[model samples]
Target: MTTDPQILVQAICTLACYSYLIKENFAYRIAEYTLVALYTSYQITRLFHSFIKPYWQNYAIGEKQYYFILMGALGLLLYTRYAPPQYRWLARYPIALSVGWGLGGAIARSPRPVFTQLMDVMRPLNTANNVLFFVFFMAVMSYFFFTTGKESKFIQGSGRLGRYIMMIGFGTAFGNTVQGRISLFLNRLSFLLTDWLGISI
Candidate 1:
């Protein structure tokens, strides 16, 4: 069976992206830039259609004129970065507002997942897997605490335990990395053999 035109185009783009593994050349760079440009254009279109146009046309023009004014002020403030050195400090107004709003939003949403979950994990009395999890947690935490003199027997013992725990983590991570690389290699090999050379997998 023949592939669709859209599938053929996608396959060509994928091959171009995979070409980077062989060497950095025009094909890879072109594909990379093309993908980025397409994504950026799509995002700009989405922002205008979904946010700016709808909000301005429906809400801001009617009962929310104040929002339009605020948006204009914020937009002008963002442009202050292009001003002369003497006026460049004006950019801080928009920057500060953006950061403050972002921080508030993040903090409002963070506590339940971050603090509550941490507290729940630390509360060994209420935990179902308390023994195993607490031992693992303490072993990992001990790896970073060096206040106890390294020369002391107790400190040396804890340090050895921590070292083993860390080694195990590192070993697992390394194994995962190798597996991922092998998978990537296999994918490229499949593309080269099956697509370009027309060999059946």
Candidate 2:
């Protein structure tokens, strides 16, 4: 019953998307394509305003940091992907540069996460939960000792416990993911019922 244009359009799009659950049709396709097109255009506009414009004005032109122009040109080379067959190879230089830079950055930053987890695991065993965590951590670490001989019963028992702990951790993660998705579904359903239909619920 809402008269607001934005809310009405949102409700219509939501229904169009949910219609696919019943059966795919032109309405669902229209909604899906519209969402993709809108999202793409929004991202392009945001990139231009947030990054390209500022970089050009501040670095390339104003501050005489002309190297930014070369960077921009390199980025432009990525579009050579759509060029004719013979000319498409020009895109690989930019692609290769990007890959190398990304890999180097990732490698440099990767140790931070490992160190963070290690620090967390090295917490004081002052509480029951902390003690439990330390024991579970050791068990899991023992399970990965591929070089160690499995003749000892202690290692076998620890590894078996580690496997069950891992299963529980995985199940918890999966349940959290499902809960997040259901939360989104509930929000959309609430919008349809309360905002669109003007219901009190």
Candidate 3:
């Protein structure tokens, strides 16, 4: 096997991680702590490069955007949560502002995709799949209707069908997730046995 320094370190770390599969021990704990440290360092570096530096460059040098200063003050209000009890109420201001801003942004961007989906649902039922989709959409909408319980036969049937459709969708998603994880595990095993150990198979 070619003893490349980077590959050797990576293989050691991978082996340390896989040791957890046998039983969690010192090697696994060391690997976990190493990964956490690396992740935290990467996150701090990203925050500096992506957000803090950009905002600083914009507000401090080029654009001189005064509202950015206000934004900073609003963000600082979060620290009031640790202040004296009387001043802790100031924390709610930032929370309220962020929540309201997020809500409005979500509402603003939601209509277009919703309309696209509505158009898709209301499109021509030329094929069997289209017909099934139409029935499923209507049934699911019926399931969400809060006014009527399953008292009426029509509502009962639609709601039950909707529940079954939802289960099918969930089951399909879960199955794909399991298949993907299995593939990942097999790929890692191949890396260990073939790449690191240089075993011909």
TM-score of each: 0.74, 0.87, 0.84
- For candidate 1, list the clashing residue pairs, or say none: none
The deviation in Å at residue 45 for candidate 3 is 1.7
Candidate 1 lDDT score at position 195: 65
**Residue 25 miss distance in model 3 (angstroms):** 2.0
Question: Per-residue CA lDDT of candidate 2, range 1-201, in tens?
Answer: 999999999999999999999999999999989989999999999999999999899989999998898988988888989999888888998899999999999999999999999999988989999999999999988888776637878888898889889989999999999999999999999999999999978
Q: Per-residue lDDT for 73-163 in model 1, tens only?
A: 7868778788888888888888888899999998899777877766766755555578666676676777677776465776666667878
- lDDT, model 3, position 33: 97
Relative to the true structure, how large is the alpha-carbon lDDT of every model?
Answer: 0.78, 0.93, 0.89
lDDT of 3 by residue, 1-201 (tens): 748887788789988999999999999999999999999999999999999889878775679887887888888999999999999999999899999999999999989899998998986889999999999999988888767855687887898899899989899999999999999988888887878888866
Candidate 3 vs. truth: CA RMSD?
2.4
lDDT value, candidate 1, whole model: 0.78
**Ten contiguous residues minimizing lDDT sum, candidate 1:** 1-10
Candidate 1 global TM-score: 0.74
Off by over 4 Å in 1: 1-3, 122-129, 149-156, 170-201
